[model samples]
Target: MNKDNENLVKSYRLLTVWLLSLFILAGIFSVLLIRLDLNLSSKVTTLFWLCFVSFYFISLLLMIYKTERVYYINYITHKEAQQATKEERRAFAYKHLIVFCIATFIFVIYSIVSLIFQYPAAVDFAVFIVIIIVSALRTVPFKLKE
Candidate 1:
């Protein structure tokens, strides 16, 4: 395989590992949070959400600026994108879709578990919706300027 194909393969492997690690860590964190039984006051809940939103957006911006260039082919400009084969594009899209599905599954399970444990689950639901919207936007087909 050529350099580009090798890079794409590496990116897929990295993304898979990173996402799996995230899922495990999230599961552990959620279990600990539930077990702690920390009843957060309204003020603390609001502050938690505020901080979550702020950090989430900041991290997203950083990922778009830094990680996408390294791991995502769709981040290229139209001219550069034109050089990529259709198969490459399709493969990348499929990989992204798989990632989205896995993430959605993880979050959905987390939300259900939170509800079952009688923990505050509104944040989990909100995060699930945000993930869906973000994945939808990211997976929208890109048009090349003719």
Candidate 2:
């Protein structure tokens, strides 16, 4: 196969690995949270939420990194990318960054609101937001770069 093809395969593999790793991490966290709810005292539930929030952010960061990698890979594989104007690349970057920021802000806001209301669903929602923001942001950047 050609270099571009090789790169494409590598990119796909990398994306797959990142996705699988994320799935495993989420699964482990879910199991642990369930166990915590069942075995621990009620007070520990708050701790679980906190843990969830932290994990959420960590996942987000990882996703962003992955997105950047994917975009970089695309740029490398696309020969015409060199011919593209610099402003075009910057525009793409800006758009993706804005999307990432908006998504992140939404989830962060939700988490804050939930914390204030002391709502049970807040924890899960916050965690969900984090995961979504992470995935969306990551994918958007990579795709935009193309």
Candidate 3:
């Protein structure tokens, strides 16, 4: 198999892993809270969500760095990438970054609103589901550099 194709698959695989991990993390948090019979204040729940989102963003940054190095900057600048155009590679990066930013921004907004309003206990789980769905739906085709 071609190296570029392999790298593209790896990126998508990592993305799926990231989304699933976040979803599971949120689910477990909810289950544990209930099972432990711990009463959490609204402020505490908000704080928990804020911390979770911070960790998610950090992990996502790491994944983006790894995939960007493999596909956009390092791979495209290599000898085997002679057929790849720099402009196109950069455009791919720019577009995906924008999508990531916008999706995360909207999610954060919804989370804040829900938390402040003291929504149902399912809010966190719902947020996780939305995030996973959004990310999965946004997965781009694994285009390889020719």
Provide the global lDDT of candidate 2 against the true structure.
Answer: 0.51
Question: Clash pairs of candidate 3?
Answer: none
Off by over 4 Å in 2: 1-10, 38-94, 118-146
As for lDDT, the candidate ahead, 1 or 2, is 2
- Per residue, candidate 2 scores C-alpha lDDT tens digits across 1-146 of 23322322224555566567767877887798787776754434554555455455445445534343324433444444333344444455455545555565665566566667666765555565565657565754353335
**Prediction 3 global C-alpha lDDT:** 0.58
- Please provide, for model 3 over 105-142, each residue's C-alpha lDDT reduced to its tens digit, 9 standing for 90 to 100: 66667667767786765665677566756764674552
Q: Give Cα distance to truth, residue 86, candidate 3, Å.
A: 3.1
Task: List per-prediction Cα lDDT, in the order shown.
Answer: 0.50, 0.51, 0.58
Choose the strongest candidate by lDDT: 3
**lDDT value, residue 17 of candidate 2:** 68
Ranking by lDDT: 3, 2, 1
The TM-score obtained by model 1 is 0.36
Question: How high is each candidate's TM-score?
Answer: 0.36, 0.45, 0.47
Q: Which stretches of candidate 1 lie over 4 Å from their true place?
A: 1-11, 40-131, 134-146
Tens-place lDDT per residue, model 1, 1-146, is: 33443333323554465557656765775687679988866544443443444344334334433333223444555334345554554554455545565555565566556555656546655766677677657656543212
- The regions of model 3 sitting more than 4 angstroms off are 1-67, 70-83, 141-146
Worst ten-residue run, lDDT, model 1? 64-73
